[model samples]
Structure formats: structure tokens, C-alpha cells
Target chain A: MRKNDMRPDELLKMDRRLVLSATGGMAAVMLPVVLTSFIVSETARVVAAVLVYAAAIIMAWAFVKRYVGILNAQHRESEKKHLSEIAMLVQPITTHLNNRALIIPVLTNQLNEVTKQTESAALDIGEKFMSIVQRARNQAKKASGAFGRFAGNGGSSSESLTDLSKKALSDVIESLRDMVGVTSQTLKNMEVIIEDAGNIKRIVTEIEYIAEQTNLLALNAAIEAAHAGEQGRGFAIVADEVRKLSDRSNAAADDIRKLISRVETDIKGIYSKTEKSITESSARSLEAETVVNDTLRKIDDVIGEVKKQLDELGAETESLAKDISSIVISMQFQDITRQRIEHVIEPLMSFKAELEDITQKARSMSEKIHEWEGNSSAEWLEKMYTMESEREVLKEVLKNG
Target chain B: MGKTVLIVDDSASMRQLVSFALRDAGYDVIDAINGKDAMSKLNGTKIEMVITDLNMPEMDGIEFIKQVRNNPGYKFTPIVMLTTESQESKKQEGKQAGASGWIVKPFTPEQLIDIVKKFAR
Candidate 1:
């Protein structure tokens, strides 16, 4: 039968048996005493019987009290043993909690160092990046401005490449125009020389005609002198000499006419060649001017493209600097994480302390385990919370629980 | 030379964080492990401000603030409590112990700098 099912008498049967056995043995010894007392006198025998009954009752009471005392001692010993066992079981858990609590600070310290280093590095990177970007921006601006001036976009006082190219091309075109003007003037002078050559040819033709006529006249005079015979011998000799002079003059006139005709032909040939040269030079000058202008325009376009690219580079660098700043700002989470870990460490340390107290109490078995009290869970939860979010969670838990 | 600020906390990470923020803001920072250590560091230095955490060993922030208030040199120095404790009772205790301001933990660098600029001499 289960112990709870036992009757009160059955539960006390051992004590009752001890009391009855003691009473029975004492009564047997007391009965002989009472009978011996009867030999003295009736009153003495009655008093002796009463004394025997009292002695038996006293002996039974002492025996039962001793047995109960032994049982109580055994129960106390068992309780102490159980408490010690509990202490032994709890010791390792307390130690583990203590170790965790002790190491958390160390871990946080190391984390702090790591975070500090990272923050310093990130800040340094940001500062350096900003500095570099600033420098690059300044350089790019300068380059863009210079290119603008070179491309003649900005109204810079200094001569730009486009302006210079235009000026040089203008100078070349003006020089070509001047050359064409000079060639035209030369062609006009050639025309005047051709006209003068015609006049010289006409004069030479006139001299040739005069010389031929004089020769004919002298020949007629000589014939007439021959017909007059001896008397006109003297006149005939003179006419004959005149005729020889006329013949020589006519030959000289013929040479002069031939020379003038060749001179006219050479002057006409020079005029025709000079006119063709002037026409070709004018065409080439126009082509050269067109090519120079087109080249200048292409150069201007290239400079514009370079300036645009430089501006984009500067903008991109500025964006990178902003990103670095954001990264440096994000590093603040390390401290927040450290606080959260500390919250955990605090509870573990408290638990360790309470466990240690319990273990000490259990070991001694002098203090009641139920008497021990620690901070309430709510109090611990409230105390451990360091952040608003944690407090909100606590509120939720309390509200729900 | 910049203004000097002292940071007192038991957690190394917290001290580092506060120190980093203050230093980044161009303030000279001196850090101590706890209230007792912080007290020892107050030796005639021209500390413009003190930011400390509560629940430190050797001496807590409240007692440290009281001690600082007791000292004639630091009596009027602005002491701001930087701690995890957000309870009104703790805040009142800190205020009564002569804290000039209170900042909960996990504060942004901007907030810390703003408070420093507002209070530091």
C-alpha cells in the first residue's frame, strides 16, 4: 500500500510496538515484585503493585521517545545529504555563469578596440578622400576653364586656339588676295606692253616701205644716165653709187621688220600664261581656306568634349566622398552593440551571484532554501534594458504576460 | 588648443566610443575606467566637462558626481551622466548628486557633440 493510504494507527505501528513490548517486559518483571510485596502486608502489596504499574508506564514512554528521536535524526541526515547533492549539481552552473560574466567584459573591450580602429580608419579614409577630391576638383576646374578658353567658349582675353587658327587663316587668305591683286596688275602691264609692241611693228613696216621706194627711185636715175652716153658719164656714175646705197638701206629695213614681228609674238605668249596662273592660284586659295576652317571647327568640338568629361569626373569624386562619410557614420553601431552585450552580461552575473548564494545555503543546510529571494524577473528585465526598444519589449511582455 | 572632456565608464567599449565621438568633434578626451579612476584624474587638469556612466565599480556615477560637487574646484563643472539606466529614479538621483545633464546610452555622435558644445566651458 502507498504511504498516503495507511491509517494513522498503521503509520504509528512501530512506535506502538516498541511501547507495547517495553510495557509487556516491564509488567512481567513488575508482577513478581508485586507478588513479593504481597508477603509483607495487604496495603504494602497494593502500594507495590501501583509502583510497578507506574514503573512500566515510565519505561514504555522512555523507549518510544528514544525511537522517535532516532527516526528524527535519520530524517535530518537525509535532508542534509539531499541539500549537499543539490549544491554539488548547482556549483558547475554557477561557475559557468561566472566565467561567461567575466569573459564578456574582455570580449567587449576587444570589440571596442576593433571598432575604434575601424572608425579611425574610416574617418581617415573619408578625410583623405575629401582632400583628394577637393584637389582633383580644383584641378579639373582649372583644366576645364583652360580648355574653355582654348576652345574659345569663355570670353578669355588671351588668344584661344580657335581665334589663333582663324587669325592665321585670315592672314593666309589676305596674303593670297594680295598675290592675286599683284598678278592682275602684272597681267594689265603685260597687255600694255603688247600694245606698245604692236606700235613698234607698225613703225618698222613703214621704214621697210620707205627704203624699198628709195631703191626704186635710185635705179630709175641710173638708167636715165646710161642713155645720155659719154656726156652724161659723170651723172650716171653718181646715180649708180646712189642706187648701191639704196640697196643696202632696204636690206637693213627688212631685218628690222622681222625682229619686231618676233618680239610681238613673244609678248602675247607671256600674257596668256600669266592669266592662266592667276586663275589657278585663286582657286587653290579658296580650297585652302575651307580646309583650315573645317579643321578649326573639329578642334573646337574636341575641346568641348574634354571639358565635359572633366566636369563629370569631378562630380563622381564628390559622390564618392559622400558615400565615405555615410560609412563612417554607420560605425556608431559598435557602441550600441556593446551596450546590448552588457545587458546580457549583467543578468548572467546576477544569476551567478544568486546561484552561488544558493549553493552556499544548500551546503550548510542551516538556512532554508525557500527563504532565499532574488530580484524579481520584472525588476531584472527593467534594470537590464538600456535602449528604448528593449523597454518597449518589456512593456509588451508585461502587457501580454 | 581645444576644450577638454573626461569620459568615465567601466566598459572599455563605451569609453572608446564616447572618446572617439568627442575627439572627432575636435575636443581633447581623457578616459577613465570607473568613478574612482575618474576622481584621481581630476588632479588640477582644466577639464571643461565630465561624461560618466552609472553602475561602475569602485565608485558609481552618483557618488562620483557627489564627490566632484564637494570639491571646490569641480563644484560648478558640468557633469553629464552617460549611462544605460533610463529610470526616472536614477535620473533624479543623478540630478540630485549634481549632474548637469543626462544622456542615455547608444547616443549618436551628433547628439553627444551637441551636448558637449552646449555645456562645455
Candidate 2:
């Protein structure tokens, strides 16, 4: 497959096939089979000529053999190219396979180590951090709940207060309406009272006129009675009394008209102020409604924000919960890892444990290590420990004996 | 003394989740939405631990980690890759990028707390 192992000009060998086929052409010309048929046919002499011609044909065939040298050289070069191409294709694959074989075990060990560490860490974390997470979640829940309660309380109360304000404003407006209605009635009643006052004034005027007429008549009668001298004196005195009564009646009617006029003036003043107050109260109620609407909108916005926060908090707590479950699964791995590692290192660990303290404790170390490191089935270690324990027991028995 | 941890994840829920576990283990929590946000927070804040998601919309976790380690402030800070990946190549890449360690995702609240305590503390 080396490059130089093959000669150059490998493709030129295709011409050798053409050269070898060209040799068949000479058979036609040299054999002259048709010519033989035209001439005297055949015998040893003709056969000798044929043999000589065949010899020439054989000798000329050397040219064809020479062409194979080029062909072989070309073949060799192509074989080399093919071999190199194949090598190019295979090299990386082989390298990869080998690399994988080498890396798998080592990587698996490292991964296992990582798995073990993560597990133990998880257990330690689960035992330690679970409470913390739970506590945090609990606290968060509590805080959110408190905030929610506070939000609900504050929002509702504010809403209530605004509502109450609105209601009070409405009540005031309604009361004002009633007041206006009553005032309007009072104004109408005042108009009627004013008309009555005018009627009283007209009646008083009539009474005055009647009184003047009656007084005039009574005077006439008194004058007439004077003319008749003594006989008429009694009649004239009676007429004078009648005139005095009419004057007293006129004075009383005048006093009643003055009282009515005073009342009408007071009513007119009150009606003017009441109309103005009604207009002001209506404006105030409208202003109050606008303020309530604005406040309500603000409170609604705050509630919306709080609700969004609460939703976020809820999702976070749920995520925290999921994390806890994964951690627990990791703890299971931790337990298995602990046993696996303990078994792998039991002898070493036991030796360490021994150096620390191994009197009565040494007796249980085998079983303890066995139970702890279940994956490590070092039966020989177990046998060795059993022999030691048995020997110790025998010594004790002998001493007691 | 508790560790200060900064969680950088696009999801608000995820950040809250990590914050809960970390804060519970006596760690103070800081948060960022993505790598750019984390970088900004880091520049403005003091944090020794950062838990970040690998895949994010703007500035993924890997690039962020690389940038963080390159910066003077976070040369030795523990940057734990919190992800749902188990690919060795990705881990190798993370290692190459100067990740301190990795924690697989969908982790239990307890496990996350444990891991944060282990690395952060």
C-alpha cells in the first residue's frame, strides 16, 4: 500500500487490452484461409507455411506481453491508491473504538464516584436543607397569605369606605332634592299667602270705604235730628255710635294686611337661597361620584398587581416542591452509594477503625462492615475475621476453664 | 454565615424555586433573568455563587459562565451548572469552560438545597 511500491502510469495499462486483441487481426492476414481455398488445398507443405506463420504470430505476441508491464505498473498504483483510501477510512474508527474501550471503564468509575458524591451530598442536603426549603416555603405561604388577607381587607374596606361615601353623598343629594321640593312647595304656598294678603288688603280698603260712607250717613242723620230739635236728639246720638264702630273695624283690617305683607317678604328671601343651595348640592354630588370612580379604579389596579405576584409565588413554591422530590431520590442513591463505597473500602476503613478502637467493637466490625458495604462481598475478609473472633473466644473459654 | 447565591434563569418560577431552597439553607438570594442580566447584576453586586440554566433566550448559560470566569471578580467563584443534561460532552465542555460542578435538573427541593449547601457553603 506504499506509494512507491506501485509504478506510475497505472491508467495506461488499459491500452494493453487493446494491444492483445490486435494480435487476432494478424491471424486473418497470415493464415489466408480463403486464399488457400482458392489455391490447391492443403497438405504438409501448406501446413509448414501455416506453422511458420503461427510462429510469426507467436513472436509478434511479445509486443502484447510488453504492454502488460505498463498495465501491471498501473494496477499496482491503483491498488496502492485503493489501499490508502481504505486506510484513511478505517484509521479514525479504530482509534475511536479503542478510545471508547479505554474511556468507558474509567469514565464509568468517575461517573460512579460523582453519582456517589452527589447522593451523599443530597442526603446531607435533604436532611439539612429540606427543612430549610420547607420552612422557607411555609414562610412564603404564610407571608403571601397574610398579604392576601391584608390586601383583601384593605381593598375591601377602602372600597366600602368609598361606597359609604358615595351612599352618603347620594343620601345628601336625595335629601337636598326633598328639601328643594319642600322649598318649592313653600314658595308656592307663599305665593298663595301673598295672594291672600292682597285679598285682605282689598277687603280692608272696602271696609274703609264702607266705614266712610256709614259715617257720612250717620252725620247726616245727626244733623237732621238737630234740625228737629229735642225730638230728634235721641236718634242722632244712636247714629254717632254706629259711625265709631265702623272706624274700629277698618283699623283691624289694616293691621291684618300689614302682617300678611311681612310674611310674603320673608318667604321670597328663603326661596331664593334654597334654589341656589339645590344647584350647589347637585354639583357636589357629581364631584363626589367622580372621585369615588377614580378611587375604585386605583384599588382595582393594585389588586391586579398583587394577584400576579401571588401567582408567581405559587409557581415558585411548586417548583421548590419538585426539587425536594428529586433530592429525595438522590438520597436513595446516596444510601446505595454509601453501601457500595463502604464495601469497597471496608478493610481499609476497618483497619482505620481498628487503630482508633477495636476491642469488643472489633467483634462486630465484620458484620457491621458487611451490612454497611453489602456490595463488597469479600468472603475471605469475612473468613479471616471469623477465624480471629473464634480464636479469641477459645482463648476466653480456656482461661475460664 | 450563609453564602450569597445568584440565580440566573429566564423563568421567574425557576428563580423563585431556587431562591427558596437557597434562602432556606441560610443563603441570601439574588436573581437575574438571563446571561446579560446576570452579568449586569454581577457587575453591580457581590456574589460568590451563581446557579444558572444552560439554555436561555439571550446569552445562554455556557457563554455566561465563560464570561464570568474570565472576569476578575468571578475567577474562583463556584459556578454550578443547573441543568437537565446528562451528556458527557456537554459536561466536558462545561469543565473546559471552568464550571465548578453540575447539578441535574428537575431536582427535589431537598436535593437542590443540599447541593447549594454543599457548594455554596
Candidate 3:
């Protein structure tokens, strides 16, 4: 029968007293005949009456034994029915507890494995985070060091590199200007020297003209002296000497004129070359300055970019370090979580233990109930006591849970 | 020459992390799976410093430190322990075994590097 359909009180409510009372009434009716037969007996009759009374007593004893046997059979049948009902009441509960006990270990093992994996994963993540942040910090420091060294070379921190290069270029240009000025002055001096040479050539020409006239005057005086005879001879001699001296002086002036002409030619050639050289050098200088300024500007742009990158790297490294630290702290949560899981496992284990106790009790109680129904009354009562001990254990499980 | 550091840990990920960090900081790194592996790698190789985990299979950090200290070539080498064990007694055990210092688990990269720089160089 279903546990819900079987009531213990209803099973135990059977009345055996009605059969006992009917047996008692049958015995009382048979007793009066045996007493009358004993009262009328002579010697032979007395023996016969005694025999009838003995037979009646024997019949009454058999009837009482039969009634007791019928009652014992009914009691045994009732006990068998009770045992069946108790087994039905406990079977499902025992099966349910057994299944729960079987599942608990599996669940606990899975939980432990998950907790272990989580801890491992958290530690792994923490390590990776540390590595990344460390790499970033190192790179930042390197870049910053390189940038500092580069910028430090410029001396004053506030000075713009472009301005420094510009100032250097301006100095070079000023020197070029001084060189150009000196070249211009040298050309002017060459011009004045050339004009002085032209003036000397004209003076030499006038000397040559004076020498020719003196020679012509000496020729005329010589002819007049010849007509005057001896007095003219002395005058002719004086004119010849004066003509010779004048010719010599003209020859010297001619040589001086030729030297001045050569000197003026050389000075003119020098002035022309100097002027061309100055022009070429000035053009080259300006080209060089432009190239230098362009280069400086490019260098300035590169430096600015490098500095900006270094600054950003520094900031990023700082941010990464903070992020890594936070992640490292977060890894601690795994430890706490594992501990919490352990706490959960503890209760689950206890529950499993209690369920196992209950299942054992149910199985034992069912076995004892079977033994009680099969065994003699004395043996059945002893087994019933053992069943009560099992019940107490099950009850304890229920109370603990 | 770049500075060389030995990183010993049972966890492959942890070893990778430490090696990467040290390499990034311009130091050359030698990786070992455990203290025993670290011992094999240390033969005749010049190591400036060592970073190891305390709990590991085969050989632990304390014993590794002791072995490193006993080696004539690495007598003065600095050894740092990286571990989950935070107890003072455990720390003392490592220290007694010749560890230069110790860092708890989940330590920041910066903290690790700083210790490395101080001890390694």
C-alpha cells in the first residue's frame, strides 16, 4: 500500500476479544451436564459419569487452544500487513536520500575543480598584467632618458632650438657681409691706382715731346754756328750736349711709362677677379645659410615630435602601472572566493553525511521489520528493539537536517 | 653586456611574465620551470640575480636558495622569492636559506622591477 494510504493506528485497531468471549460461553454450557451426571452416580454409574466429565473437560481444553491459535494467526497477519505498510512508507524516502548522497560528491568535486581553475586563471592574469605594465614603464623610462639627453645638450631649457640655429646662421651672414665690404673697398683702391697710371703715361708723353723739340733746336744752332765759323763751334758743342741729355731723360721717361702701363694692367685684372670672386662667394654663402636654416627647422620639428612622444609614453606608463596594480589587487578575490566555496562545501558535506545516515537507517529498519514478521515472537520482539534503535538514528538525521 | 636574471616558477605563465618584464627592462632572462630546472640552467652560466616561487614541485625556493648560496660561483648572487606564502615564519625560512628578499603573490610589476633593479644590479 502507498504510505499515504496506510495509517498505523487503523492497522492496529483489530478486535480479537469477541472470539475469546464466545469460546468462554461454550465452555460454561458444557460444564452443567458434567456436574448432574456426577451427582446421580452409583458405583458403576459414578465411573461412567466421571468418564463423561473428563471427556467434557478435554473438549473444553481443545476449544480454548483452538481459539488461542486463531487469535495468534490473526495477530501474525496484522503484523505482516503493518510491516508491508512501513516498507512502503520508507522506500521512496530511502531512494531519494540515496540519490542525493550519490550526487553530493560529484558536485563537490566539480566545485573544487572550478575553484582551482579560477585561482590559477586569476594568478595567470595577474602575472600577464604585471609584465605588460613593466614593459611599458621600462620603455617610457628609456624614451624619457633619450629625450632628456637630447634636450639637455641645448643648455638652457627655455631656449628654443630654432632660435639658437637662427642666431648661428645670422652670425655667419654677418661675417659674410664683412668679407663683402672688404672686397668692395679693395676694388675701389685698384680703381684709383689704375687712374694714377694713366696720369703718369701722359707726363711721359710730354717729356718725349720736349726731347724732340730740344733735338730740333740743337740742329738749327749747329747750322748757324758753321756759317759763323770758330765762334759758332763752342755754341754747337753746347747744343749737342743739351740734346744728348734731353734724349737720355726722354728714354728714362719712356721706360717709366712702360712700367706704369704694366702695373695698371695687373691692377685692373686683379680688381676684375676680386669682384667676380666676391659675387660667387656671396651667392654660395647665402645658399649655405638657407640650407642650414632649412635643416635646423627640420631638426626642430623632429625634436618637438620626439619630446611629445616621450611625454605621452611617460603618461601611458603611469596609467598602465595603475591598471596593473588594480588587476593585481583583483586577483585576491580568487582566494576569498575559494574560501567561500569551501564554506559551502562544508555544509554540503554535512548534508550528505546526514542523508547517508538516514538512508542507512531506513534500509536497516526495513530489514528488521522483515525479520520481525518471519521470526518467533520472542525473536520478533528483540528485532523490534533493534528496529527502534535504527528509527532513533533516522530521527536524529531528520533533526540534524 | 646586458644584466642577466634567472626566473624560476612552477607556473609557465608566471615565468613568462617575469622573463618578459626583465627583458623589457633591458636585462637578459633565463627561464626555468622549477628550482631543480633552475639548477640545471645555472651550470657555468653567469646569473646576476634570481627570482623564484616558493611552492613548486621537485624543488622549492628555499632549497634552491640554499643550493645557489652554496655554489662558489653564485655565492653572492641575490635571490628573491615570489610566493603566495606571506607568513613571517616562511619568510624567515627563505631568508635563512639565503634569499635576498621576498615579494607576496599578486605583486605589481613596478614593485617587482624595483626590487630587481636594487638586487640584480
- TM-scores of all predicted structures: 0.47, 0.37, 0.54
Clashing pairs in 1: none
Best by lDDT: 3
**Model 3: how far residue A318 lies from native, Å:** 6.5
Off by over 4 Å in 1: A1-50, A53-61, A91-153, A161-163, A178-278, A312-401, B1-121
- Interface root mean square deviation of every model, in Å? 5.3, 10.3, 5.1
lDDT of 3 by residue, A103-215 (tens): 99999999999887986797678677877886887888887766666554456553454556667787887888788889889888888889989988998889889888888
TM-score for candidate 1, residues paired by index = 0.47
Docking class for model 2 is incorrect
The order of the candidates by DockQ, greatest first, is 1, 3, 2
Quality class of the docking in candidate 3, CAPRI style: incorrect
Clashes of each: 0, 10, 0
lDDT of each: 0.72, 0.66, 0.78
What does DockQ give for each predicted structure?
0.10, 0.05, 0.08
- Per-residue lDDT of model 2, residues A157-246, tens digit only: 544443565556667657766766776676677677767767877887888888888888888888898998999989988988987876
Output the lDDT of residue A304, model 2: 66
- The interface RMSD value for candidate 2 stands at 10.3
Error of 2 at A348 (Å): 8.5
